[model samples]
Target: MDWKDAIIAVFAILLLLSIATTYLVYHQQQQTIEVQEAIIEEFISARHIHIETTDSAEPPAFVDRYGRVSSSIVNIIAIRSDTGLGEIGRVLIEITEGDGDVLVNTEPFIKPLVQYSVREAVEVAANFTGTNVSKSDITVSFEINGTVIGGPSAGAAIAVAIIAAMEGEQVRHDVAITGTIEEGGYIGQVAGVFEKAVAAEKGEITIFLVPCGQKQAIYYERQTEEIEIFGFTFTLAYYTPREVDLGEYMAGKMDVIEVATIGEAV
Candidate 1:
């Protein structure tokens, strides 16, 4: 074959090989995407838990006497297995006249601390509203949307909801709270304040209430430094926790208020 013909044959072969390789790569990518989607679907189906919803037609047992009240609460998902970042979920409280029992409905069970928080919330609410908690029953429900929640951080919000129910008052939908309920109706500090605040802001909460001294969030700032030892330079990295006022940080976004007690929050 002539030199020109040989060159032309080689180019044609190379072009055909390139096209085959591209098609194979494209097919493999499509297969990978399909497998990923299937895995996600399976994961969701397996981990899915049923959340009970109140029917409008059928009135809740609490509506007759002590009115049902609900407040939004922010909780942190420390491990972002489902979502890439931290997410917040809602807590719904329903109170009625019963045997002072605190009931919770959630998937995969609930933490003992969460149950204790509900009891504390009941006490705090009773003190605030001057009602006999022994004559009432509280049912706390959680809505899980790609987030697993279990903590005492929602104690303040539960107390607020119970108090509102006892007083026949409604809580502001635009407000959310995160803190632990303590004796004397005081709110205690909890972790993940900053992460919870960001989630609350994204949820369109206008007013976010936190514990007394939690108005500022402590975050670790990464610092890198180079040190020379024995004519050799080494790089070191460290994190320093710095406090940032949550209120000031979220100024135009939302209002972050610090409440020492449930009464102040109410």
Candidate 2:
């Protein structure tokens, strides 16, 4: 029709196109936001899922329980590899949900034993608490504060910590134990009971638990005898077992109690 009419018609079409493009872009952005929100929700839900044991198809009652737990700093007595003397060391045990991993921040030589101890600790803890955790993913992490040779002597302490963690209880900071963990929640005897007791006392642990019948520490005393044979002098050196009564020795310093099982120690 007329030139002005034609210009107005073109302007109207351009405005409509611009509005349509803006609507499309806004709609796509809204969809993307929805997708991101869904993903975030799913991830959070997955994290909260309770780990289950293989013994039963139903989840345990403690599901989503104990997201993270840390035990009181344990006063562990270890012998120095170079000095061959008992040293007081500190270790903190942390338990969390993981793919059945044992993390040790100590010498590599003790990794395998620590792993075994963790597994046993878990088993013992589950049985003690009447729960099943064999198939549940768990991570046991150890943080050591001093340089000392590692061994299974800390098994009892580890088991005790695990039980406390699972039950949402706190282990007394003034108490410590030294022994190997055995089946049926028993505490197996370990060496260096006297040395460990001394270390525990130094670390301000008022109550120290040792394996059964270990309240008396047995040490060896060096004995030397010299004799002359065929105009030649010979010297013989031997060691004799000597016992020290821990109760009398540490009478006022700390109380050294003998424990037969992890339950008793706990």
Candidate achieving the largest lDDT:
1
Q: Give the clash count for model 1.
A: 0
* Candidate 2 residue-wise lDDT, 29-87, digit = tens: 98986786567545533433222445555544344555444344455666666755667
Residue by residue across 1-266, what tens digits does model 1's lDDT show? 98767767886899899999999999999898678656754553344222233334433333463454433332322323454344666566676655556777756355555666777777777766656555456788776564555567788888888777666667787888888899889999988787778778887888999888899887667899999754557688999989999999999999999999888998
TM-score for candidate 1, please give it: 0.64
Q: What lDDT is reached at residue 91 by model 1? A: 65
What does the lDDT read for residue 229 in candidate 1? 50
Give the TM-score comparing model 2 with the true structure, all chains together: 0.66
lDDT value, residue 72 of candidate 1 = 35
lDDT of 1 at 80: 38
